[model samples]
Every structure is written in structure tokens, then in C-alpha cells.
Target: MQDPVVEYINRHPNAGWKADMNSRFSNYTVGQFKHLLGVLPTPKNVIEDVPVRAYPKGLKLPKQFDARKAWPQCSSVQDILDQGHCGSCWAFGAAEALSDRFCIHYNVNVTLSENDLVACCGFQCGDGCEGGYPLAAWQYFISSGVVTAECDPYFDDAGCQHPGCEPLYPTPQCQKQCKDLNQNWVDSKRYSATAYRIASKPYDIMTEVFTNGPVEVSFSVFEDFAHYKSGVYKYIKGDYMGGHAVKLIGWGTSDDGVDYWLVANSWNRSWGEDGLFKIARGTNECGIEEDVVAGMPSTKNLVVDSAVAAEQRASW
Candidate 1:
């Protein structure tokens, strides 16, 4: 049934990757896959851009780098999230990266809610589950800010009673109230001081991640990506599915000399190589090099509350 993905892999043994039907998306329609990929095309910038930080001359980037290994203290970068059946990858990506930066820059582990952005960002970010611009998600972070997931947990995987359990679920309502009866929204929100696109060059992207932390990126996802099982991935065969946003964790060269970008997907740990995949790097594979977005976490409207951190540390 999913022979095409395997056929392509078998024909290209040196393709540096393999595919299988482990995802159970074999029965998924093209529309279903496309709908889950939420990154929309880039529109005009509505936010501030920061100058790329300059590094020391003759700086040498490590041949291998992984955010999980580099910053083991920041647990947020190690978590693999599930976006479920929703087209909220853009929100998920932006929120995830901002959360990591909060831990890296501020030394606190706070998991920001994609639900807050997906439901509330509205036109500024774009349609919640239908699709959205990656840049707009970061812009929304600067303006409206987002709450902690503990305050506004994702609803997609909840029971059938909740609307999020339905297929192609309508966007959740933009409610500022927290799920916990005790917590309120206004005080729980976290802000970003700034947001911007990284220059599309490989060195520029690599340097940004290597210097600060992981960043959010949107890339073209093809059909064959759905069956990815293991190894450094390079698209071998498939129709264009849609744009997918993910957390760019690091970069490295495979033993075979293939340069790859280490990415953390929002599709849960079961979907790929333990909820992560390596895409061809330096080649702008699938437009991965384009539309990179990230932000510096801010404490302007909110603080990285210690009690909330205690709760997160317990739950996480």
C-alpha cells in the first residue's frame, strides 16, 4: 500500500535515509497531510528585525551540534511535541523556539502554549489550523505574547467531547482565561523582546543556532516525508505536500559526508526518528533555508514565575 515511498528508498541505497509505513498515515489523503502542514507563504514583515550578531573572526563551528546535548540544562529543547491533526505547525514552531530561548537566555524552563498563539494570533499569524505564516507567529509573540502550556494546554488530543478531537477541527476560541480555575491569563503571558528572519545562507543560519539557541524554520514537506523512518533525510520522490514549520535544533555531517539539519517536529516522537529528522543542509533542500524565524524572550509583561517553574519541573 505504501510501496512507492519504499520503492524510492530501495532505488537510492545511498539516499542516506529510509522510509516505511510506521506513521500509520498510509490511509491519510493528500489533503489530510497538507492540512496538517500549517506554514503559509511569507507576507510582508510587520515586526522589527535584529542585526545578525557578529562572531569572532576565524570562528570554527563544531562539525556536530545538537541543542539537546549543548544545553542539557534547558529541558524544553529536548521535548518532542504533538500538534495532532491540526495545521498549527507555525504556531507550534514559534512557541517552541521561544520557549527554548527563554530557558537559554533567562535560565528558566517555561513551555509556552501553541494553543495560545494558534487560537489568539488570528489574522496577525493567519488561520489557526488551516495554515499560517511562520513570521507572523513570531510577530504575534512580540505583540500579544503567549501563555504557558500549563495555563493553556493543547486540546487536540483530548477526549471526543472537546471539539479538538474532531478531524480538521475548527480553530479553538481565543480565550484569555487559563484552564486551571485558579490561574488567570494576563499575568501568565510571556513576551518576546524582538523577532526576525535569519539570513537564508547556511553559515548565517548555523551561526544563529550555534550562538544563541534553536530557531523556528518552515520548509516544504513532500509526500515521501510522511514515511521517514531513519537516517539523514533527503527527498527522493514524492509530490509537494505543503510547508511545515519545525524547530531547527542543530547541524552535522553524516559519515557519508551528507550535511544535514537536525530538526524537531511537532508531530510527536513516533512520527520520525524519535520525533526528530535530519534534512539535507546547505542545499536549501525543500526551501528549508528560507523563512527562518526566531525571537528573544522578554519579561516585559510577565515574569518567568518561580511557582510556575516548580509546577513545570514537577509535570515535565
Candidate 2:
């Protein structure tokens, strides 16, 4: 029997979109799909307090812009990362955005630790792996700062290689200390964001990505998205799961001339187009254009000496 998800995809007419059944999520049940995406509800209070930056009056934006192609040095336009079976997309999205922004600001390409935020940002960000809020995660970055992936690498289901390291999934105890499975520790002060901002309007969000780099965005995910292979996705039909967060890198038009937003997901290279996907633009499909959040890296002088000195000593 054909999988219902696959059947649905096969039946749907292509309206500038296509779905593939060969991907990993083809057979996942609605319940299972929902479990994999763990974006928590937007705390009304936090959203209300988050300051919005308005684009300067009448500033014209180019018809198209892609951070990856435009600022290749700062963009981590690499393979899609696998979050395993854990619900750490929220942490990954926020951390990845900060990583790219830091590179853009300082010309250094360092993979910031998503595990650090997942296991240490505390309850304020959301329960590690189980779920989290992107905004709260960014706020955590500003206040507590996270370290590099070299300091604390990500290991969702494939338990850490280090002998004494405990697996962190479903839910793990928050440990602010930065250490690898090998027990070696890195100073938390080495890498951390100093400030962040919220961009609610579509233009403001676009400007942030154009001037800065990628920004973290959360949006509603439906069952149909699991089979997304290529083309601009526009919510054909399916059960609305919770929310999923990703990094919005840029925007462009498809060969058919459909406007789309370029986004990077954490589902690894096996899913989507090499771990990247494009959604319809302008109309805010899936509420992606809403609730965008971004942050600035700490000043070089603030932690450069400490970070460089530590890197020199440990070669991280």
C-alpha cells in the first residue's frame, strides 16, 4: 500500500512546487512528524517587549539578494545539519544565525555550539531538545553567551564518543560548563553574542539578512512539508504540526519566475535540496516572515583577547 503521505504528494498537482517520496520523512506518521519539530509557543510577553526596527523611509531593496552568494565569506552555506531525533531546531537555528553573523562582523568562520545552548541556556529558552523558543534562545545568547562547536559538539541520538559524556535528548540537564565528551573544557567567555534585535516586517527582515547575514525564523510546519524536495513550497494541504525554526539566508525567483525565500533547515542533507528549501515569498507562507529574530556579536575587544588566547593554547 502506498504511504498516505506519499499518496497525498503524488496526487497534488504541481503549482510551481514538487514533492519527493524518497526522502527520510516519507513514511513518518502525523504524530511522529509533530514530535520532530519543537518550536514552542511565542511567549506573548516577550514578543510584546521585543523592539522592532523599522526600515529607513523609502529605502529601496534590490529585487533579489542572497547572503550565501553575496557574502560567501560570512555565510555558512554548507550541508544541512541533522538534529537527530531531538527537537533542538530552535537552538540550532538561533546558534547558526549567530555563527554566521559573527563571521560577517569579524571575518572569522567558527561554528558556534548549538549543544551549548540546548544543554545550558536553562528553562527560559525552553526544555533542551524537547522544544524551545527562538527569541528566548537569542535572549539567552545576549545575556549568557555560547561557545564554539569545538568546545561542545552536537550529538543528538548517537551518544557522545567521549566515555563519560551523557546523552542529551528528549530532555537533558542544563550544564553551563563547556566541555567535550573527552572531559576537556573551554572557557564560556570565548564566544557569545553581545546584542540582538527583532525584525517583524518583511522588509526589515530582508534588510537584516542583506546587511548582516542570516536571521533565525520560526514558522508553522504541516505534514506536506516533510516530503518537500524542490521548488517554492506554498502549503498545499496537511495537518498543521507545531512550529519549526530555520535560518533565512536570502530570497530569489525560480525558473518559472515564482518569488521564494531561501532557507536552511537542520534535517541533514538527505532531506530537501541538500538540506535547503525555498518557500513562497511576499505572501508570508507558513508565517515565516513573521516573528523574525537576529542578534549582533559581542565587540572584538570585549572577548577577542580571551578567545584568541584560548584558541592559541588549545588550538580549537
Candidate 3:
């Protein structure tokens, strides 16, 4: 039997996105899919103390730019991270963006730990795992910097489990310390963003990505999005789930000439074109162009000597 979501997508004659029944999300109920989306709180104003670099103007930007291609050193580009059943996409998106920016800024590659933020960042960011806000996650980065994935690996449930199946995953708790899976502790000062900012306009978001690296973006996820395989996604028909966040890495036109923003998702590599999806650009389909947040890595954090010295002095 065809899933109702699949049938809805298949039946839509002019739907801009293609639907795939073979994907893992084919049988997910609307409620189950909606549960995966986390609520994003309103973005707080930018911190005035942090230095904000003005983006260069009058320079021609390429019609397309892929952060992965431009900075292959960033392993996050090739890797597809999974948030499992937890509604921690907010943390994942912001952490991934910061990871990319850290790499671009320092020319060093390292995966920042979303688990660190998801579990350690308290109510100020949002409820751990249950839901969170991307902007709040970035703000958390500014106040309490996060650690690397090597120090605090993701502890959420894996996506291979059936959609409705409960995997006995415990609620995440904030440790507020940097420790690896083996329980070895690392210096927290080595991995944390000094500041963050929100970019709403489409051009601003693009400029941030081109200049800094990927930026965290949130958008409304519809039921039909579960079946997205390829092509530029435009909302066709589906229940409106709450907002979901992802890392916006680049933008370009598809072979069919449809414009799209390339985004990295936290749903695992098995879903949505190897855990990456593209949505309609310019029109801000699903409010993607509206809520965008990014962060800058603290230069002091990038320097091992300074970071270690600061850690010793408990400065950060």
C-alpha cells in the first residue's frame, strides 16, 4: 500500500520536488515526522561586545558556491551527521555551522560536538533533546563554548531504528564538561565560539557562507519533505510540522534550471540524498531564508598555547 504522504507527493502533478517511496521515511506517520522537528525560539539581538566583520560589497559572487568544494579540509562537508530520534536538530545545525566556520577561519578541520551543546547547554538554549532553538544554540556558544566531537561524541539513538519504534534512549542530561566516549577529559577552551550573529536576508546568509563557511538555518518541514529525494523542494502538500534546523552550506541552480539552497540535515545519510537536501531559493521556501544564524570561532581558542594558558587560568 502506498503511504498517504507518498501518494500525496506522487499525485501532485506540478510538485517541484521528487518523491521517493523507497526511502526510509516512506512509512513515517505525520505525527511521528512532526515530532522530529524542534521549535526555534526568536533570535536574540547580536552581542555588541563581539567584533562583527563587515562583509565585502561590490565584489561579484559566483552564481554558485559549495563550501565542501571550496574547503575540502572541513570533514563536515563529506560527513552526514545523524541526530537520531531526538529533536536536537537545533543543536546539530548550529554546531555543524560553527565547526565549518572554525575550519574555514583557522584552516584546521575538526567536528564540533553537538552532543556537548545538546546535553550541557541548559534551558537558556532550550530543553535538551526534547527541542531547542538554533539561535539560542549559537547564543549558548557565545556564553559557554562547546567542545569537539572527539571530546563529547553524540549519544542519541541511531536512525536505523523504525520510525515509531522506541529505542530505550534516555533523556540527555547536561554534563557541562568535556569528556570523550571513553570518559577521557579534554581542555574545554580549545573548542568554543567567541561570538555569533543572525543573518536574515538571503544575500547576507550567502555572503556569510561564502566569506566564513556554512551557517545554521531553520525552516518549516512539511509532510511531503519526508519523501524528498532530488530536485529543488517547494512545499506541495503536507501537514505543517514545527520548524526544523539544518546547515546551509551553499546555493546553486539544478540541471533542470531550478534554483536551490544546498543544506545539510541531521536525519542520517540514508535519508534525503545522503542526508543533504536542496530547497527552492529566492522565495525562501519554508521560511529558510528568514531564520539564519552563524558564529565566529574565538581566535584565542584556535591557538593551542593561548587556549591552554587560558584554561589553566580559568579565563574562559
Q: In order, what is each prediction's RMSD in angstroms?
A: 5.1, 5.7, 4.8
lDDT of 1 at 170: 84
Q: In candidate 2, what residue range of length 10 has the lowest lDDT sum? A: 186-195
Global fold similarity of model 2 (TM-score): 0.84
CA lDDT, every model vs. true structure: 0.82, 0.73, 0.73
lDDT of 3 by residue, 1-316 (tens): 1367677776777776778864555556556566578765654543334444345466577889888899987786667788876778888888888777666666567788888777887777777767887767777777777777877778764563756667434456766555545443445433445445545566767777887788888898876787788778999876777889889889998888888899988887878788889898889898888777776676555554555445533532
Q: What's the true lDDT of residue 101 in model 2?
A: 69
Say which candidate scores most in lDDT.
1
lDDT of 2 at 302: 41
Model 3, C-alpha of 37: deviation from truth (Å) = 0.6
| Cα lDDT tens digits for candidate 1, 41-118 | 766555344444433446588999999999999989999998877899998888899999888776889899999988
Deviation in angstroms for 231 in model 2? 0.4
Best-first order by lDDT: 1, 2, 3
lDDT score at residue 203, model 1, on the 0-100 scale: 85
lDDT of 2 by residue, 7-126 (tens): 666677774667777455644556655766879996776566666655774767777887777867664655367776678889888888888866666666777778878888868888
Off by over 4 Å in 3: 43-57, 160-170, 177-186, 189-194, 304-316
